[model samples]
Target chain A: MTATVPGVRRGAGPLPRALHPGAWWLWALCLAVVASRTTNPLLLACLIAVAGLVVARRRGDAPWALSFRMYLLFGAVIVVVRVLFRIVFGGGGGETVLVNLPEIPLPEAAAGIRLLGPVAAEEVLGGAYDGLRLAAMVICVGAANALANPKRLLKTLPGALHEIGTSVVVALSVAPQLVESVGRVRRARRLRGGVGRGRRAVRGILIPVLEDALSRSLALAAAMSSRGYGRTGAVAGGRRALVGTLVIGGLLGVCAGLYGLLDGSAPPALGLPLLLGGLAVAVAGLAAGGRRVRRTGYRPDRWRGAELLTVGSGLAAALVMHLATEIDPADIYPSLTPLSWPEVSALPLAAILLGLLPGYLTPPPPTSEVPA
Target chain B: MARRSVGSAALGALLALLAALLAPLSPASAAPGLARPAAGSAGFCPDASGVTVVVDFRELGGGRVVRCAHGPQADGLAALRNAGFTVAGTNRWGDAFICRINGRPGVDSEPCVDTPPSTAYWSYWHAGDGENWTYSQRGATYRTPPEGSFDGWSFSLNQEEGSAPAPGLAARRPSDGGGSDGPGGAGGDQGGAGGDSGGPGAGADPGGAAGGGSSPGGPGDAGELPPDAESDVEDEEREEEAEEEPDEEPDEDVDDDRSAEAAPLPTEDAEWSGTDEEFEEQSAARDDSGGPSAGTVATLGLLVALLGAGGLTAWRRRRAAAASTAGAGADERPADER
Candidate 1:
């Protein structure tokens, strides 16, 4: 139990305070970017492992922290669904046939489409690889959700995005809130000598939990509004219009720039120049709009060395993976047609290993007994 | 209660209908069928007994290849394979949408994970002996090429349907009198029911007609009687042509090699050997399947170790918290309770 003092370094370890929510988000999103760059299951599994390790080490004893298991289950479901789709549709034209399912002949209109036929090992593995990539992305986001406090994340948002951030934070917290409500409701039911099982038990628990959650959220909304959470100082209509135009136009430019960068065939003018220009314009607009709002922070989270190290480690992982893409694309995207085993290169593996740094380098999350 | 029973019955009927629709119409047939053992030639097929496959690597920068495929059951995809050509399809569409042939646009160029953009893709075409190329409307998996026909794959980039370049080689067989302009003469007798040979303007007609006609029979039925009969007749004619021109095979092989060496782009005479030992070696290397490599295994071990470390950290934290709670009894309740 240490006080939330600024720059209180004690010997080797930093003081046990929660890392900035923005730092956790940046780290997790960078991990997601690493996952997106490759379909190799080995690399994806490594990413999932990295995310799980970080979550286990850094997550506070919050209700939302427990939802990581649900995300893991969702990821499993995604892999299963992808494999099932491969089975239901034709499992491609790979040479290695694993199962000979009965082939269903479709009508002439559906000529190219094959219903269940022979399942190929290659096709199933390919589906699994693709599914793992998506799962890694989802789990990375989930890790961020578990490790970072949603309210704190909203607080970090710029003034221009405060109203939107408030809504988003509320939406994000709903699942954890509902979970807490359910537990409370079930505990109450147990005290009243009711069996918390079967269909009747579900109905009894569900109604009260929902009601409790709704009332709690309503109270929160009331509290937030009373405190003038989304209030903005009066500004001239023309100034508002100028800010709106700048933001919207910048956002459009960013979208165009991203499209151009991802697509090799797109014109050169729309790529890096547009992206930088759009970012500059957007930042300027946000700054101008923020000047209009009158707000003060109450012990706002500080970005210390630990936060810097955490974000830097994640960025390094992403950068290494990007460089790996240039070195050997074949290793990143293994051929599935011939059913070769997916292999990860040394460089990308080392990059993923770097993702483990934040788990050890950042101070352990403060024990929950410490009062805020 | 009565309404609920009625709804259940309706649901049951719907489920039954779906099951029936999905039920296999016949016993499982061998999917690849009985493709003849590949006897790919260095040039255009010596006779009309087989389908000749030509791959034009236009913008992808490879010389044109002509190889012959023999079999009654040879569809467009089968013909390509039977001609000793390896093809890769888009992951989304399987063998239906041809993405790469002999791995031209490699993983770095096009990953083949999805349907390639219309800007760059292998455009499918079909032609008769000494006939103009027609763009195929149907996918390769569904369309069965008739005996004596030519299956062409040209890598088209940002080209419209009409403008997409076809395989550089003239679809003429060497036995068709070595004349450059013999399509008119050959079209009269050899152009079968499927071969609607005209100029590029008339290409769409044959393709559209074949697509519509073949739908009812499907790929399986389309590969049956006509091709068998045509192959038998052509087999006899091929023997006669072989008797007449005994020394043309080696001469054509030499011609093919020379043309291949001269042209960087695909040209009429530039026919690279699809069945070359070099190509076989490359394909063999590509198809070397095995278990995970040493690096992958090491990485997996590292992942496992990380997970273990995570578990240890979590367990330690839990134990330390328990010790603290036991030591400081009613002074602090658990955070979960709050």
Candidate 2:
């Protein structure tokens, strides 16, 4: 296949040389953080669309990539389910009533709980806003799943995490592989006699699927071992214990720091310092662990200018949303009273639009298969 | 005369209970004066030149006081802030867990209502025409007061046991609920305040609702201005006030015609808090006048544009896939033919 775009070197080895997989995860994470920062639907929608565009533009012809549509469908379901829950459980008192369900009075003990009460516009809007934020987050995770090859991403992990990353990568790849396996078996069975129903067919299909998964897992284990997977240098017991302690302590500090930043009730001291100290300790542990791992990679992925730009776009979106929330919190959490249009600020919205840059700026993913 | 004295004596006892209950909060509120400055006036509303907010501090012993403040669209929380009363609350229920109104905390006490327990929390009520109070169905953040109203707040100690009672306050004007309540023309004078005698609520509303709250000359001018025939015209203004939230959200006609900035400001009605209300009114004005400010428009525009780009990307990918497949089929056909 001929390269159509200028400045994209065909000598960059076969068209569509894979992007640094870490770039995709970083980008998706940034988009997710932006979604979490605001309840504004318009901003969230833009973030979702940008993710969708990037996924569509760059995603390889892989089953994991195809799963993006599933995320979108799931997002729609979440919104509908959230609204339904609000309709079923929401009590009266919101000014704008969309639908009033018959109220069922309960015993005094059930005072706060309302069943089948008026479904107000406010409740629906609130639910939809909340659902949309959650859906945006889910979609970001899905975009990362769809765009980045999990095995490729695992390859870029620190040497200390190499063994763990491989198992995780294999575990993730199994779902998509299982889906493909099931499809293949079904098609083969259809060729024989349009898959018969009842106990016989269930037995036939279940046996094959389980057998296929076992064989696949064995093959994966064999392949991993053949690649000199267990290679490690000797380390003193005391030093190993120290590394473990630092790693565990750092993880706890990070957890505490994260909770402090996200929760208004947590103490002030647990926030920045704890996060920094935890990160410092975790890095030290990672460095120590790396020394014990005697391993090399095949053509390790380079972090180039394009990779930085891709990651930066996502971080930029998150930073912009942070500034917006700081400047005007009211727009982020609009009032539901006297129901009117919730105001959206230009700066934050502009920032979200900035996420669209990678969709256009990065070289388009080369089609994997040669057409002619 | 003996029965009236007994009633007054009961009222006096209730006040002492209220004052004692309020003792915890009075330090923070530094409440202007508990001593009834006059027989029927004091506490927030000096007299009834504006809307009277009745604080039924039931947990702090139930008695009510009248305070003048902005209506709900202007944020009733601002009313507490305006009166120099500090309110402690959690945003958990969006400012609904108002544990302390002034310094008296309803939570973390000896009986300890941990955070937001339903048994002992602040409940809200409102009285329109200053007659009978109605429970505010929604939380304070979402429920702005309707036209010509009195705001009531009560701290229910044990609402789980039974219904919380409205604070039996003497400040409430005795209700002879007739005449003035008629459509559109409620803006006209009632000729007499009746049992309320110097009733601030009745005295204040027409001037306030008709857009006169901004001007101090509001009440006296509304009192004398064509009390009989031109009453319905005042009702038309009051009717606009009836749909005031809608009135506030949109620009020009209601505001310009209402502002009447020119020609000596003819007894401006609508009990607007002027400064705070004007700031909110300006925001609303920007929204209504320009259809939407640049921020909203850009947000919407960017959203649509990004979605469109996503669709375009999908389309381009599809076309590329088709072209490649077609190219492959053409090449394969020749090889198979050979």
Candidate 3:
């Protein structure tokens, strides 16, 4: 049985190990950045495909790993809702009328806002493009969730954020834990020959599941407290205040910087310079605060060549998309007035293909002993 | 079995709903010929029966192109469109916010995907004959320009609402050829100086000359003559016309000199004629014509290929897991018995 297990077999390949969670997050974020830049359905579809492929090839047998489909379903829902809204709201005034729904007249107070007007192909296509961009962004984040181990990610959080990380990890795990608890309660009920249906069955399962989850959380909290998980070493109040100020001020600067960068009319000084300065200050603050929480890792995930390759490929994809935006914005944002087919240029397509590097380059995920 | 049946029923209902929605879709008439107003000469409308559309390319550098939207137009947007110039609206605001005129400030300068920054945008103005330009409170789509009124669009860059430059040409119609030439000629010369010193010299000349009561001569200079020797043609026409109509001949000469200085612009005005068909064709080419290009096909193929690869990997992984689970179950049972 041990020999049959691929992970346990010797000399099969490089010993399977999970890549750094941060690398996956950075890579996914870069892909999301690429998604935000363009409304071209073709490019967005390419991005979605690349993300799905990576997630399929690299996701482990974990509860979160199975949630990518949920994200895809959610993305589809977004697209449907967006298109529906366009149909209802006059379809952005195009000549190519698709569906002439009866126009609903509103009171004089709600002038300029139409309801149930003629739907145009341009409007529907515009909504799809906008929705696809958003969906691509969501799926990229989902890909990261599936590819990276949330527990490992929590462990890798800065020492200053240990308490916050603990809360986040618990919150992240709650859905899966609730699902497990419900399953266990259902199985127990079935074993006892209680085949109640609907409301009664829900009542029977819900209470026990809640009780089980509460007890499990209590036990986890107790274990963590005993292990000194969130212990803060002696730190001066003045130092703590300074760190807080730095962080808050830095965050404010970052917010302003991002606003400036996104708004076309904003002054140039408020953009890149402010963003870089804020980042530097935030990093310094984090480092200072980290010293107060004296903690060590058992087996820390190292930033290896695989991690570099993963993050670099993501950055390359983002860079290429940005370049494409500059070089051929017309292709990136296809005109919808006449309702033309969305097209993707070669460079941007190749850049999105580069996003597939980590799936092939990184070592395969360690297989779980339990079948999923 | 119950769950599968329920799912299939829901899908069938969805399909039915889709069919119902699609049933109302009539075959769209391809490229409907829109009611476009006839292209007019550079000045205000020759009479009160039309709406003159003045597009001032301020800072964008093309000078003003005044075209008349003939007939009774419904609204400012309709008039602008009818005047044979192309108008592009922002994606977010639809026709509420005018983003481009005749494709000025190209996509590189302004993407037109969203509400343009307030600092740089086309400011709409309205004026009655001989009245000062007033900033319009309502959007172009909402406001109806009265026949013989002026609908102006000036590109406002880094200017406040109060300071936003109106169209350089004043709202003065051409005088009815006889005694009105005194005030009209004075207005024309003032407009000429304003046009010459501020931006391009050509836009103001025709308006000036037309207002000066030599309206026929001004149109003849711009429309009848070729672009290269427009100034010479204007001089010869001015001399001959001056001989025939000596009353406003001096004003026509002064206007001709200014028009001569900015001669190339009149050629543009002449070329701008018959743009309605061209504009429609351009839009049709952009919107309807092209099938998917090679790049689009390649992108779609790549997407499909990736999806297929991903599906294959998932299938292979599921099969491997099933095999491993069977092997593990057999080994565990034997060990338990032992």
What are the candidates' individual DockQ scores? 0.19, 0.11, 0.21
- Model 3 C-alpha lDDT per residue in residues B215-323, reported as the tens digit of each score: 1222223342221223323323333222211122223344334333332223334312223333445555644334556776676677668766766666566567556
Better of 2 and 3 by TM-score: 3
Alpha carbon lDDT of each predicted model:
0.64, 0.54, 0.65
Q: Report the lDDT tens digits of candidate 1 across residue range B1-338.
A: 13222322332342243223223311111122112124455556655457788776645655556677765434788888778676666655566567777776788867777778777788777765444455666677777777666787877776653345555444555453343233453344333322233232222222111111112222222232211123222323333222222222233343344334343222233234444444555665643323446776687678667666655555555556555555667544434543
lDDT for each residue of candidate 1 in A1-372, tens digit (9 for 90 to 100): 332211224555766778999999989988887887787877887788788778877888776765676677677778768878988987455555667999999998887678899986556666777777788889898999989988887888777766677789888888767877777777778779998578999999989988888788889989998988766568888998898788778878888776665444456798778978898888888888778776789999999999999999999998998888878788887765544556778888878888889888888777664433
User: What tens-digit string does per-residue lDDT give for candidate 2 at B1-338?
Assistant: 13222322332342243234323332322222221121222333322223445554435542333445533334455444444333444322223345555434422241111145566566665544433344555455545554334566666665443354343332222222221332223211221222221123333432212211112242223343312323323333343223222211222232234223332211112211112222224334432231335666666576556656566556556556556666667644232112
Q: Which candidate number has the best DockQ?
A: 3
Which window of 10 residues has the lowest lDDT sum in candidate 3 chain B? Answer: B209-218
Of 1 and 2, the candidate ranking higher by lDDT:
1
Q: How accurate is candidate 3 locally (lDDT)?
A: 0.65
Interface RMSD of 3: 5.7
**Candidate 2, A6-26: lDDT as tens digits:** 234566633455678899888
Q: If ranked by DockQ, best first, what sequence of candidates would result?
A: 3, 1, 2
DockQ, candidate 1, comes to 0.19
Query: What fraction of the correct interface contacts does each predicted structure contain?
Result: 0.38, 0.23, 0.35
- How do the candidates rank by TM-score, highest first? 3, 1, 2
lDDT of 1: 0.64
True-vs-predicted CA distance for residue B171, candidate 2, Å? 11
